[model samples]
Target: MVSDFRKKKLLHLFNKFFDRDGSGSVDRKDFEQAAENISKLRGWKQGDAKYKETLDTLLKVWDGLQSVADANKDGEVTADEWVSMWEAYAKNPSSAYDWQNQYCKFIFQLEDASNDGAIDSEEFSTVYASFGLNKDEAVAAFQKMAKGKANVSWPEFQELWKEYFVTEDPNAPGNFIFGRSSF
Candidate 1:
């Protein structure tokens, strides 16, 4: 299951662009505009090859989940029309492993401190630099092996992976929580 911290961060990021009116909730136009803007941000310029390519990619992604948003027989997506979109995205479906893989690759690119296709302590700090953590907190996480080594064991890697997406805290406010399951 996902962690509250990750949910909060995703919600914050989603709201920043989706909730254009600052109403804490996304409206119809906001969803389309946000998608368009995201397309533009991804090196898609008007009348450019990359623009069409990126839009096509987005359409492919959204079309597969059309029922989640194309609710009114109008072939368009709305804000309320995307309730399932966010939920599905947040749930991290097994079938969407490629999506998660892509995200991981992005993080790896940002965190590869050694720039050798692997993450170490320094890479993790650079990736999370925006947090502005003090030296002590940063050192604690690094010392604790928060970032996996060049050759990380499966068990050890899962722990580091969980830090960004799965909170171990039992009292966190979120729809899902992670822990040792008996089943």
Candidate 2:
């Protein structure tokens, strides 16, 4: 069973990402807008390699969310569907972990500006900031993940991602991944 704190966090994430239109639910247009925003933030243009990469990543994520959260086959995610999905995920952690693991790898690849297979604090900060983290919060999160080191590897990132989604501790390093937000 998911802890109350974890449940709240999951809802917060759902509301943050899926409820873009603030219409109390999420539809295809919201996902499309989000993808467009990401592409714009990355400064991706048509015919560019990075554009294709970013587009693919965004589409993958959008598809995943829609497939998993839109339980009624209505092409929309309601609050009930969102809650049901997380509850089901809580019962089967591995499925959630597998999806999140893949997502973390995608994020790592996007943030590793040098293509070094790891991300330094500065790169980490930039990525988190794009997700709404302030500069200081992003740095703190980086330090927490780095654990006195200079960079974070894929395995370590996977751990952090799991903790970020599953752990209830507000002060946990993973909690800082998305920066300071009211839970």
Candidate 3:
């Protein structure tokens, strides 16, 4: 049910994080490298209190995701595996539904935010970081979607937010957006 604009935006986000060569599709190495870079960037300083804090935060986030990701008897997660993992998480986000709701609600509450009801660059970075993506890679990924434009519409936000779960619908009617893949 995503509009073309939203789908493109989501894909653009994915491209920022996972398409190292600037190709549209994500490869395994690209995904791995980004994850590693994010970790390293946040945990670079050894013996610093901030490093420990970052490590603790990273571990906490990973631990929460691990139970859901340790599928198919593998200790390591590949790109497709991780994508599928998030896809499942998006479907039933009971673990942090209230948290996510409050986060989005807070974004909407910002005065001078915008009439479109979406958070802007600074707001998105702050909120997205608070959601566990506290690194440049994460910021870049979000920027790809936000595009520094003032306020994405509510429907656009909803559509892009739900993208981790929904596949593109290729059979869209006239004037409707369709999935990128074709039969």
Top-lDDT structure, candidate number: 2
Model 2 score (lDDT)? 0.70
Misplaced by over 4 Å in model 1 are: 1-6, 12-86, 89-92, 130-183
lDDT of 3 by residue, 8-119 (tens): 5345444544454564444444434544444454444546664455445444434444445547645444444546555555556554444334423433443113445555
The candidate that achieves the highest TM-score relative to the unseen native structure:
2
* lDDT pick, better of 2 and 3: 2
**Ten residues in sequence with the least summed lDDT for candidate 2:** 174-183
Under the 3 Å rule for N, CA and C atoms, how many clashes does model 3 have?
Answer: 0
What's the lDDT for all of these models?
0.43, 0.70, 0.43
TM-score, model 3 to reference = 0.39
Name the runs in model 2 displaced over 4 angstroms.
Answer: 97-101, 181-183
**Model 3: runs farther than 4 Å from truth?**
1-44, 94-144, 147-183
Evaluated at residue 145, the lDDT of candidate 2 is 64
